[model samples]
Target: MIQLPLTPPGQTPLRVMTIAGSDSGGGAGIQADLRTFAMLGVHGLVAVTAVTVQNSMGVKGFHEIPLDVITGQIEAVASDIGVQAAKTGMLASSAIIGAVADTWRRQGMADTVPLVVDPVCASMHGDPLLHPSALDSLKSQLFPLATVVTPNLDEVRLLTGIDVVDSDTQRAAAHALHALGPKWALVKGGHLRASSQSPDLLFDGTDFFEFDTARIDTGHDHGAGDTLAAAIASALANGSTVPDAVAFGKRWVTECLRAAYPLGHGHGPVSALFRLNG
Candidate 1:
């Protein structure tokens, strides 16, 4: 059994952790998560599962972190700093996913912690981030443990084998994903074809809620998913309900995308931290 550290001095800050890959370009993955946590007034911790060679243009390759190293990071942080809520993104293989699931159960976090699972399958430029063979493990081992599962249209199709092109399909996909285990399912409709509004569908096995924002015309959204998931986890750590957390995350990410500036020659990252100009 893993024993967590007691809260040490002063007013205890909300604590959140991100278990994900490292994006070298600083646009997505752990980088986006940390930025969002700080922006939302949470202390962020990370356990990197892989390192990707990526830029604004694309992901060239990746190297998975050793399982021992991954477990060590998670154990070190969980035992000492502790976590109120956590989020997972871009587990590159079944090995990493299984390790994470085992670690969570071992630490007694599976049922108690608020865990947001972002089913990140690929990069913005069509590079695969997760191994195809790991899909079963993700669905069987990790999905059942998630407090909420966030999947974009592409991921919805990938995970559920349903092409999510319209509202009806989106709802069906959300239900299908919900059946796999999460207490709530949020299907992000950002890439829906010919849609004027980007609508995200949230279903908590009983009720359905839709959150929509005007589709901003921009290509500088390299780390949007990571930012959204991190923001939701941050909100959860700060004691928001699932619906409220999703709403806050959506609003924050929309603003970040709106204020995004070109950083690289190719597509740039959304501004997780907006500028404070006079």
Candidate 2:
């Protein structure tokens, strides 16, 4: 009998964890993150921070998971299956943020894994998603541990007290945010201009990368920021460097927006599977 050659051990897929709220509408939050990870060919794991009763129109209501439960979920994922990179969105309370930071520190995973903080404070329809008190905790604890923080203009204003009206102001705001200790800061420009092109600024401590894309003039963009940040985390988990990951993420989100399909009565989600069909 001829002996067959034995196959070597299979390599594990890049694992990414999303700590965020659940979007029942499946347009944003954990749902969007998982979809983005799947599109990027990575294993997506989730630790839901809260559950929102929402639809395309607006958030109806929300129930935040207790701090201990949040901590347990993070611990369960990090200690057992492990993660290459993690991204957080919609951390509802100051207690939750504090607990999450503590758990990450205790696991010694704070320094090893790349953490992307989306700082999702509110919904697309002007409803608050995070508690007002959580801002201080996020700034003090989570920001310092983040590998990258992806914040929109309003979020940047809230975090750094800098109102970004133009490109120069955006640059100044990015620099100020970077000074808070995150290794990199991505200031999203989606909310900035409707007439001009949309440009996102990425600051890596010393240098700046201005990513400009033709703004897709469409109403089907409910979860664009969440998708962008998740794509970045997925790229990082797949071993892409910071700048390359951000670049690819920017391109991916732009495509998603360009290829978006209107789903709901109001703002719709981007087509996360656009690349799959390409």
Candidate 3:
């Protein structure tokens, strides 16, 4: 019989938690987050708030986990193992969002743990992931507790009634979003059609850091937001400052999109292991 080698103590990996939905497609949501955490050398934990029946084409259906179950999962992971940072994605309803925020506040971990909120209201294929009524609850409960709020043009428009088509509009939207109480707001420019290159605007309530990258024209970009937010959370868990983590996360996602693989009939997924291959 082969004997397993025993490892030394205190060699545990950096832990990061994701409070989000589970995508059966394995391209976005918690699945993408877990893959990103693994690639970035962080231990990934999940508190599943909903389960989505999605595919390469689009989201077929979804079911929300009970509020108690969601809170129980958060408590179970946060109490025993503990997490350095966390990210949220694809919350199904207003009640769910409120429950999660309340639980986190009750645990008194809001200040200690860095939380990245990816306001994922719709799928890349234009399918609705969040209920319409949940929008207000998300703004009221989740946004205030976030260390950083990552929103694309569509989500930013939904969050703040501003159209971010040009650079000036982008700046205005970023500042408006920052006023919503998050320490930082990263307004992504993937939907900005005027510019040939993608320019994401980052506002830390004071200054703006614009990250411009050549947009990789590919159909395989199913989990870009989840990937970015997860990478930021992992970076934070590894002791990076907010701005540094956002920059690193953007770089990682850009590389991932550049090396994306064609896997499905419709939009596939970005390669989360691009760094390893290089």
RMSD of each: 4.7, 5.4, 4.5
Instruction: Write candidate 1's Cα lDDT for 196-274 as tens digits.
Output: 9989999999999999999888989888999899988988877789998898889888888987779778988888667
Candidate 2 C-alpha lDDT tens digits along 1-278 = 11112223486677899999999999999999998887777778888899999999999999999888888888888888989999999999998899889998998988899999999999989899989988999999999999999999999999999999898999999999999889999998988873288889999889999888888899989888899999899888877888888888888898889878877688899878776674
Q: For each predicted model, how many residue pairs clash, with residues at least 3 apart or on different chains? A: 0, 0, 0
Number of the candidate with higher TM-score, 2 or 3: 3
Which pairs of residues clash in candidate 2, taking residues 3 or more apart in a chain or in different chains?
none
Candidate 2 lowest-lDDT run of ten? 1-10
Model 3 lDDT, full chain set: 0.89
* lDDT at residue 12 of model 3 (Cα atoms): 82
Query: Where is model 1 poorest over a 10-residue stretch in terms of lDDT?
Result: 1-10
Q: Which pairs, if any, clash in model 3?
A: none
**Candidates sorted by TM-score, best first:** 3, 1, 2
TM-score of each: 0.94, 0.94, 0.95
Q: In model 3, which regions exceed 4 Å deviation? A: 1-10
